[model samples]
Target: MSILFGVVFFILGSLIVYVFQKKIFKGITEEDVVCEVVQKAFIRVKNSEHNEHKLVRELLKSDAFIKDLSLTAKFQGSIVGYILFTKIKVGEETLLALAPLAVLPKYQKKGIGKSLIEKGHKVAKNLGYKGVVLLGDPGYYKKFGYSSASKWGIKSPVKIADENFMAIELYPDSLIDIKGVVQYPKEFGI
Candidate 1:
């Protein structure tokens, strides 16, 4: 009976670790991951335009909309994923928004993006952020508690499809009675 119990406990422990692998094995720090993440995002963005690195660098440097954020992932001694958030203002209130999150082509589907986002939210909540906004796939972001910003009377400053713009309130009533345009930093050019 003792041996059987030990086997059962061992299996259960392994299952727990497997299920929560990312949280259990977070191996990268914010400082170590930023440059690599920026580099990966730049490569992906460059395909869409000339001087993409310059443009992204300018955006990161100038954007006041990004705050209380950091990048993280399992490096395996090389950068394989990245995520970023910046601060944005809606009317008189400020909120954090996730933007331009990316992972290397070979690294997608490994739960890295989800891990970064989940951990990022915890950190933001710890820092007393009330809400998080993002423009992304409804299918993907919805899984993370994102909902249409329009429901809260929040819209992007630039013209964009309503479905692509979403926000999640980390705190109860974070968006209560708050409604206005979502403004990005000048570097975003939108």
Candidate 2:
């Protein structure tokens, strides 16, 4: 009995130490951080329609698109959060679309998603994007300056919740009077 108890305690203590080390010392490399986080998030979402892994590949390869803005959080050298933004065009105007924003199950509620979105927006602004549009929970995106796309005459090609389709103008007069169907990439299948 005494020997068995000692073995169990040793195993439990090692497991705890490993988790703590991962939580404390991990950091993501600037180049691969976003991809890693997105991959992990895809596993968590388990969405059949988007095939999140494929989407990431296509987005990275598209020449028509601008930079893929993403952010990631890491612990013990593993990414725990992610967000992705790609270019979307409306008529002659250039804008961006946010999609596949996610965080690891263990890291949810730690402001990882918020950091990703906020930093991505700033990067998009710097790169001269006029605005960003996304289909997401209003309660969440609204805090990041998103408003209903209907307000600006922007509409999704497919049926989506009215309040869920949202946009935010990066420039003061960017989307003012500019209204048209949002053309997402073919990969979106809509």
Candidate 3:
């Protein structure tokens, strides 16, 4: 039908216009912008904390904060995406935890989140991190190399589905010997 053909063209058009800037998040100076991005990104999620901006504020002040792993994606001089990977405890090893990755509602999909994750992984690998863990949609995260945490004996303190609680090694065999319940920072209130 003509309507179906029109829908296809619209989808392709949106993808063609998707582009953004990504860089190490400027701490303190850009905190409010990042908070605002987080707010708008999750405005429709029924189970979202709905106050994730507050969590980001607390995490920034926590010892787990990692300046280099904090990244933002900007489009046309305005921040449109943000991703924070903080330090977390896994038995004796210290790994990164990716949380609250946000992309503005209007900008969702179109590879913004994908690019941010790829960049974060590269930076994390260079920083000598073993891997990154997160609770997110497995279908999406898996496309970026994430797998069930249980595959490496990693468990979450809070109950969650195996598929939703996922992780990705930064490099080959990085998590081969690591295994334990993740100890999130106090800021997470877990």
Candidate 4:
């Protein structure tokens, strides 16, 4: 029975690691995989220009791109998810913009998106970034502690629902006194 239990434990450990595999996104070589995941993830969104993959490509070449904050999740060594945090300006301070977070459709709802987000937040905090902003679902992002940007006096550069525009400070009160319209890279065209 002990041997059987040991075997079960080992199998479970391997499965966890396999499903949660993540790493810094290597450039160019892995671009296609990342783009594919982005497009696939947004395919079902109503009127999703479906050009998020293009945005990812553009962000990669933009000055705002942070190489260290771009991450990928893998399954069995194949890239299955991607997330990017790019530099954005709020007032005079530089924070982050979380964009194009994507997971292959088949891989959705399995904690992969949450894992990428938590991992990105950790890396951003380690890199000294105080906060991040994004345009996304209120309910989904709220799970990660994202709240209305308006609460921090931050406004959206474009006209957007207050709830859809959100921000999260990496640490307590990190976004205090940070108030302004978020300036996304021109690549965003917004």
lDDT of 1: 0.75
- Give the per-residue Cα lDDT of candidate 4 at 148: 97
Residue range 75-189, candidate 3, lDDT tens digits: 9998999999999999999999999899999999789999999999999999999999999998889899999999999999998999999999998989999999999999988
**Candidate 3 wrongly placed segments (more than 4 Å):** 1-29
Better of 2 and 3 by lDDT: 3
**Candidate 2 whole-model C-alpha lDDT, 0 to 1:** 0.79
Clashing pairs in 3: none
**Which is better, 2 or 4, measured by lDDT?**
4
Sort by TM-score, best first.
4, 3, 2, 1
Q: Write the per-residue lDDT of candidate 1 for residues 1-190, one digit (tens) a residue.
A: 9999999999999989887987755876544355555565556553355343344455456646344474657667766766667778888888887866777767777888899899888888888878888877899899889999998999888777898899998888888877999877777677
Sort order, lDDT high to low = 4, 3, 2, 1
Worst ten in a row by lDDT for model 3: 19-28
Best by lDDT: 4
Q: For residues 80-184, what per-residue lDDT tens digits would candidate 2 score against the true structure?
A: 776678888777787888887878767888888888888898999998888999988899899989999988888888888889999999988789877989998
TM-scores, each model vs. reference: 0.71, 0.74, 0.84, 0.84
Name the regions of candidate 1 deviating beyond 4 angstroms. 1-56, 63-68
Q: Model 1 Cα displacement at 21 (Å)?
A: 32
Query: After superposition on all CA atoms, how large is the RMSD of candidate 3?
Result: 11.3
